[model samples]
Target: MRTFNMHEAKTNLSKLIDETVNGGQPFVIAKAGKPLVKVVRIETEAEKPRRRIGFMKGQLKVPADFDTMGADEIADMFEGKSK
Candidate 1:
């Protein structure tokens, strides 16, 4: 990793970013000889595999009455009758 002072970093910001992105090399930016931040490239979505639909179709289950399970208490809360 190469170290770039504040001024040099600002002067070649785009070039540095390109090198990091294209060549996958990371560099450090410092101030007064003290390391401040590291610049690196983020992976694009294209590099990540996409999840297929219904990939876990049978991995989960829900009760048939799940929506109505909380009916009474939910209604009481809405009517300000539940504490």
Candidate 2:
């Protein structure tokens, strides 16, 4: 942890932010020798909400021959056959 005075923090805000995010070092900003705020990286992705996979599970049905269902038609089109 490091503490930066108001003027210094303002001047090096970008660099301080980079260090906080990339180096995982948090810092504090002070005004008139009193702490005003702390700069830290937000929670990582693992701590944030994630998409719910398989939310539609059981709402759709798949045929046993799903993979080959359109095989014949696709082959016919490629062979210039119509019907």
Residue 27 of model 2 has an lDDT of 96
Tens-digit lDDT track of model 1 for 1-83: 89999999999999999888897689999999999999988876666777899998999998999989989999999999956
> Which residue ranges in model 2 land beyond 4 Å of their true spot?
46-83
TM-score of each: 0.53, 0.53
Q: In angstroms, how far off is 64's CA in candidate 2?
A: 19
Error of 1 at 64 (Å): 41
RMSD of 1: 9.3
Q: Where's the lowest-lDDT run of ten residues in candidate 1? A: 41-50
What would you estimate as the lDDT of candidate 2?
0.92
Which ten contiguous residues of candidate 2 have the minimum total lDDT? 41-50
Writing each residue's lDDT as its tens digit, candidate 2 over 1-79 gives 7999999999999999988889668999999999999898987656676799999999999999999999999999999
